[model samples]
Target: MDPRQEEQINAQVIAVFPDKVRIIVDDLEDFKIAEESLKVGSYVKIADNENAVLIAIIENFQIAVSAEGKRDHIIEAFPLGILRNGKFERGGDSLAIPPKEVQPATISDIKKIYEDSVPKEASFRFATLSSNISVPVPVNGDKFFNKHIAVVGSTGSGKSHTLATIIQKAVSEKGDGFSLNNSHVIIFDIHSEYKSAFPSANHIDISNLALPYWMLNSEELEEFFLDTEANDHNQRNIFKEAIIKDRLAKFSGSASEKQNIHLDTPILFDIREVLAYAIAKNEEMVNTGEVYASSNKEKAGQPKYTQGSLHGKLTNFVNRLENKLNDSRLNFFLGEQSMKITFEETLQKLLGYSSKSESNVTVIDLSGVPFEVLSITVSLISRLVFEYGYIYKRIRCAKNPNEKINNDIPILLVYEEAHKYVPNSDLSKYRASKVAIERIAKEGRKYGVTLLLASQRPSEISETIFSQCSNFIAMRLTNPADQGYVKKLLPDSLGSLIDKMTSFRQGEALLVGESIILPSIVQIEPCIHTPSSSDIPYWQLWKEEWKNMDFAAIKEEWYK
Candidate 1:
């Protein structure tokens, strides 16, 4: 290098920290060397006498410096880092020799090194001294928020609690302006834990809530009647006809069919009407004749008529249907014969419009639904929401796909205790929760529907569904099968973080995947809105006694 060029260079070693070093230099105009591509976390080679050589550069740098003495002399303060392998002189001034060479590290190789060196506590985000390269940083974008997410933990691992924290952070984090206000989420809350978790959403609980069974397609209806056995084609048709009649009868008196009602419309069907039709169609006629000539008197045999013969036999079935229809406790399509309330009133109340805003996050409470029907009810409601969105888009964006901005309201469905519904397999091939969940996993993304599945047993969840998740929030897992299942889905880079799952705190979780550049084990923020269905303190309740003890006096007064 030329002497004039060296004179033009202004180099100053800023402060040297215990572990790292910082330096500043003028523009490359002076060094005249081609190795001026130094950056934070990059390696730069400095050589003296060809053999006395060392390398370091820029861990971090500021555009301006603010030290007291000689602060004006330094135009910039750049930190330099040297690994334990290289040594820097304590009081070395500027070296006359220039830097040798500099190059950018391969991101792939760095990622590999990162996976191997990351600490167990690190989630998808990590910074380590094992390599000179920086781990990938998770920026808020399509890569992170738009990707699918899954949370797996045991029953009490606080899955719902963790999810609430993550969503809260996503909207409030620095540098990210993404908010949940514009998002439309439809949660299939089997346990109804999230009713109060988010206050903004419209909550629809299907307890004794009636859904028109006729609204179900033939496939759905078939699944509904899986337990009933019908042999001949006639028998099957009889059942089908009975179902149709009951449906029509249930909706008959109120209003005319606005649309050409077909086998497809998802309106409420009358279970009472259908069962009545079934009984009526299956009834058998009986004929009785008195034997008159049997005892040598030889009275002629003639047909005998009984007044309540048919009525007597049909009594039990009618009673059953009437009892079901009359059960005022049940929210049935037809009001129980015993209850004076009409079906029309119940239907109106159920389908009545709620000012549910798509922008506001809504949590529907499902705790009131009966255990026997919980799985199917959850499936039906979720399917209905997605189906509604699918239809809404087709009409709004008729000709062009790009003109779908008006139709794009992304929704996230958080399934708590997802394993109960979406188990591994269905040997009988009925209305399996696994199938419904798999459909959402594969197709929900296109319809602007996303699922956030929370479960303790990953091994019990469908492999295909679990594999589709792009981001994962993992807490403690003692089950080896679950651990092994998660291991398969986890990136090799997150091996260490997976090991920490067993020791994670109640609300703490290892967050890994696209949303985070490196895996990070974070303490989730506590939720402000409390869930309604937590365990109660029975022991404490028993400690309290009744306020009044006038039992003997009350009895004496009554006797007097």
Candidate 2:
């Protein structure tokens, strides 16, 4: 039989709707083949007309026994798109087909579907179809990076490997040695797993990551220092006033007069001086009695002044401030040896824009940071990045209206374990980071900032943030709640396809949304430089021979 004639009518369409089609298979052998193809997530093509083919996925099936004892296989399919005139297209005005005109499509038709879906521009080849035919599955580079994306899966489902693959492919050069020179990607590495993966990238851990105390605004300071619910209003006001005064005193005469300083101004100030001023104000006496003459000439006539009304109110506040200043764990915020580093220097260091380095990727390792201050640290860094991008774009656009902007300093902010910071519950402890990240999700694209959030528990992440993601790389998710959460975020037409997510093999994922021409299940390629996210060898360690313990070294480090 000629292959072109294989498009001849094989199955008869018994029912049809706008979104679904039902076909009948009467031939015993053909019924078996159609039954095999009806498995969920498997694709099949229906002949919509002489030249147009309708691609659909088998979502369900039923076996019917007629009164004459003959068996009929009914296959229910969800239409994905229309392949017409040798081109695969979606959402066109001519997808609907009349009933009884459909025919079963052949393997040659499937090949055409894959070929027409390959992106025309620069793309990253992630996987091949499981059919062993080596059909190239490519994701458009521009759409994947410019839009916010989410990577969610259960543990050991290859989420880390997927992320590493994306980053490696992004930073690596093309065959022609063409690289993205202006791309800046910052990974918030919670487990310190990515430092080894990108050896050439700029890596900053808690040991060297410095965020001066003055960088925090009034609201952040309040969140960190004052227990607003517990602290007295008078004491809080005193602290605020002292901070304002110390910030203003950083500038002198002409500069001070011209500068408009707010509570959130980034300026160097001696924290000790602020503490001392607050203490002095608290200790100042107020006259409770009328003026009186003293017997001694040196005393002359003076009205006795009692201790200030706020003397004892600030004792606890002062003690808490002193403790934070002395704690070595907080050295990142308080251990600046000199006040000479300007705000511009701080921005350059945090944004990885200093003159010493031209590398575009910066990985911030958060493993060493104390848990008490982790939320604020993440909040401060994220807010600074957003603000810098926002201001830089405004200034550039104002300077040259017709300038060709190639996204010179566009930043891709990747957050691992995103649910910890952007939880759905309003009672979460990391409110600061949650608000900052949510702002970026809603409006960051306008300023060349995009987010790639990775989380194991998609249900726990903020709905606003998750819903705003335009792309998703969903790996195996077994938990019902997590699976349901991902399903809710996708379009109704893809729900049956998403149902297979729980059973996907490790390293296999469904890449959907704006990044690809079609929703596909891709086998993610292994990263050349893999992260240290593999499970520990517990059995191997248990089988090892006993060795001498280093008690002395352990004790010394523990004391330090």
Instruction: Assess the local accuracy of residue 254 in candidate 2 as a C-alpha lDDT between 0 and 100.
Output: 77
lDDT, residue 426, candidate 2 = 73
Best by lDDT, which number? Answer: 2
The window of 10 residues in a row where model 1 has the poorest summed lDDT is 75-84
Clashes (N, CA, C under 3 Å) per candidate: 24, 0
Per-model lDDT:
0.54, 0.76
Candidate 1 local lDDT, 329-373, one digit each (tens): 335323333134333443223222233333345555566654544
Deviating ranges (above 4 Å) for candidate 1: 1-141, 167-180, 206-210, 225-236, 245-263, 267-269, 284-353, 356-359, 399-401, 404-406, 427-432, 536-560
Residue 30's lDDT in candidate 2: 42
Which stretches of model 2 miss by more than 4 angstroms?
1-9, 17-19, 27-41, 60-73, 91-94, 99-119, 130-133, 173-180, 253-259, 286-303, 337-341, 354-356, 403-407, 546-559
TM-score of candidate 2 relative to the true fold: 0.88
